[model samples]
Target: MNICWWITILLLLHSCTPGDGMDHGIVGGHVSVPHSRPYMVYIRDSIQPNLNCDGFLVREDFVMTAAHCKNLRNPKVYLGVSDTTFLPLGIEVDSFPHPDFNNEPGNDIMLLKLKTPATLNKTVTIIDLPNLWNDKISKNCLVMGWGSTKYEDYSPSKVLRESNVTLKDLTNCIEPDVICNEDPFGPSQGDSGGPLICGDIAQGIVSFRKTQSKGNVTGYTRISQNLLWINVVMKQHKP
Candidate 1:
């Protein structure tokens, strides 16, 4: 069978399911070296601890994540953390989901403003955004998170995990603002809001996924598509 046929089958199965898509985790990925991904952020609601998502620091005071993660009551972020058990005290943050966000796919990006500027160090640094919007997608990309490593287990990983995914053609993507990738080893549940690093630049943010018995396809909100909005938000809300 052709690859396109398989992808179509996956999408059809996913569409048949009822309700909204579920958050994904780093399935079929391996544990990452401690603090290797300096830009990574682990987010959780202090009041409802179970609500969690991954994020990446883009500026001293701004962390980018998925808009759907804004449901947290008291959102806090753990920076420079590799293992959940050895985390430092989380910093408080105020969420700024995209103005057009409505818990949907296209506008699934958000920014978390740190109450205080983050101390940039070897173990906690910000990643750069794309310099220009490019229609051509890079072939290889990396995704890291503290989300679950398997589909059956819903518990998130204590140690961070990393996976490599190949960007699919834009024609296969569900929306113009999303970058799509389908691989045997890809994001599953609890991996929302993480960065999709392509050639050292954060090009996408983990948004949603479509799964089926055969496999799954993950979508990341294209950062380049919303670069103007991100810049404006960060500039206006500077601390």
Candidate 2:
């Protein structure tokens, strides 16, 4: 589908979801990745349990997530995540929301500048972005997130969960403007901004999944498509 179509779809999706609530904490995974690396994000609200999404560390104090995950008009972010634990090595976000994001087709992407830098270790590794045109990720990729298992009106769980899915070929999974034409397999609510990892390299940000049975496609904002924006945001916030 074309860009305009995607944008139109995005606006509709945004309108369907009610965004008038306070922050709430998530139910997270019982076990962390073997020495879990940096790729977990927590979305916060003022008066509710925070939701969990996934993100990656690009710089010491910066993270990237999908724009639609949290609307800019009402936005908050938390980084340095593992099983819902916000480490002392993490940061509370100062600002987020992507510049070019229209939130349609989930082009919605954002970068978070930490109030302080994270303390890193071997487990906290950064994932490098793929080229915008890399097109290397095929039908066999892995997705990890701290989201829900089922879709319906529900709150994020107490422990995080994850699942793997194959990237559907565009021709086979053809939807329109959105990421997957087929049904999304893994990840659910609270996973809107997580990574669509192909091997160890970061390629896309989990954005949207069609509300259907066994949807193969999970929408993601192409990270390579937003490298410039990431750089600009990070530079502006340089200490």
Candidate 3:
């Protein structure tokens, strides 16, 4: 598997500039940890650790993310965590990459099962999947991730930035060679496989950058179509 180095550079050189109308420096629009928590994963021998990304728990022990984030060479997960300081508190764990994960560019979502169930406390929590989020999410939705707020030729700032984006029609998304690209560009390099959430519903995962555009769209594997797959995965570890 050939790894792209730009992915590494973009993640490492994250720009930390706070701008107007941003999530107050949240790299992916997440503010100081939500009642419904989101988390990040760090890879070894790649870039910095404890960096942010969007994730929610399915079971107490299972945290799902994109397949590309599972570079075990330096894999680490921060549950309900925000700052780099919280990285140490993150319990290093095991990961399960999707069997058919397309590492090339787009279809790269993955699931991560922590070695031990996260110790649920007041601080750590999970977001439930909304029933209608997938069916109704067509043109308007919100995407959050730890990607670069602006294409400033560097890595995303440590803060989790977020923005509301419109979904592009699939007809346009599946052009001659294009797979996806809707709005708000996409999540920055390290923001892969994060959630494209709308309210309580998870619409899709942050896929990849559209060539040299702003960010990648949520080239999400639609939850509605993947319910059977999700159910099978969840059944493996009923909690």
Candidate 4:
């Protein structure tokens, strides 16, 4: 689709569902390649016991995720594991979305702070935020999460999965706040809040994806605009 079409579709909504048009999620067909991505996180909201979303570590104590996925009642952050049900180190803490966040007007990004800084090891690491502000970074990117492996199947994946997407130039986005990615297997339901990575730097947070078409129209919250906010929040909440 054209750049204008992508920007036009981003309207206000009840919540940021993270993918276009659906009940099930992340339509990609593959397993996560081993410990290839250890920064992936499983977020469980107390408000919705069954709803689990994904996020990533941008700092030792901060996890970046989609704002719409915000849940406040002793939320859980699970890291250092491939399987959600496995014995990975987990933490329960409060989550904070961007102060400018609203589901519809979409700033769909948030920072999660741990009560104690996560113990980083080989299995648990941090994905650096794109330290540069260049509008034209690499279009090639990788998004990993524990979302559905098929459409209309709300079943969260046993392990994390990575979907290949291209951060094409869609310069017309509103406020230039969101980035649209081209992917056949769009960021599914549970995939919300996951990071869109360019090499080791995190470029985007999986927002919403459009469905019922040839492919999903995936969108992410451009991290560049929120870099200052991220830094301020991290300082205020440093463990």
Give per-residue CA lDDT, model 1, range 1-239, as digits (tens): 24453343211111111222223336776778888999999897887666778899999999999887877768899999888778788999988999997655678899999998899999999998986676455778898887765655454677888998887675567677887777787665667889998888899998777675756777789999998899899889977
Q: Could you estimate the TM-score for every candidate?
A: 0.87, 0.72, 0.69, 0.83
lDDT of 2 by residue, 1-239 (tens): 47654542322112233333322222222334533656555555433334334566767777777776565333455555554543333346765687556555635677777677766666455677765554556555566655554454444444445555566564343322235635434655666667767777777777766444453345666676566676777788896
User: Number of the top candidate by lDDT?
Assistant: 1
Over 4 Å off in model 3, which ranges? 1-54, 105-107, 130-134, 175-179, 184-186, 212-218
Poorest stretch of ten by lDDT in candidate 2:
8-17
**Cα-based RMSD of candidate 1:** 6.3
Go through the candidates in order and give each one's C-alpha lDDT. 0.77, 0.56, 0.51, 0.70
Give the lowest summed-lDDT range of ten residues in model 3. 12-21
Colliding residue pairs in candidate 4? 12-104, 13-104, 18-207, 18-208, 19-209, 20-209, 20-210, 26-188, 66-193
- Model 4, C-alpha of 88: deviation from truth (Å): 3.1
Ranking by TM-score: 1, 4, 2, 3
Model 4 alpha-carbon drift over 4 Å, by segment = 1-25, 46-48, 212-214
Worst 10 residues of 1 by lDDT: 9-18
Residue 233 accuracy (lDDT) in model 4: 84
Output the worst ten-in-a-row residue range by lDDT, candidate 4: 10-19
Give stretches of model 1 more than 4 Å off: 1-25
Error of 3 at 26 (Å): 7.2
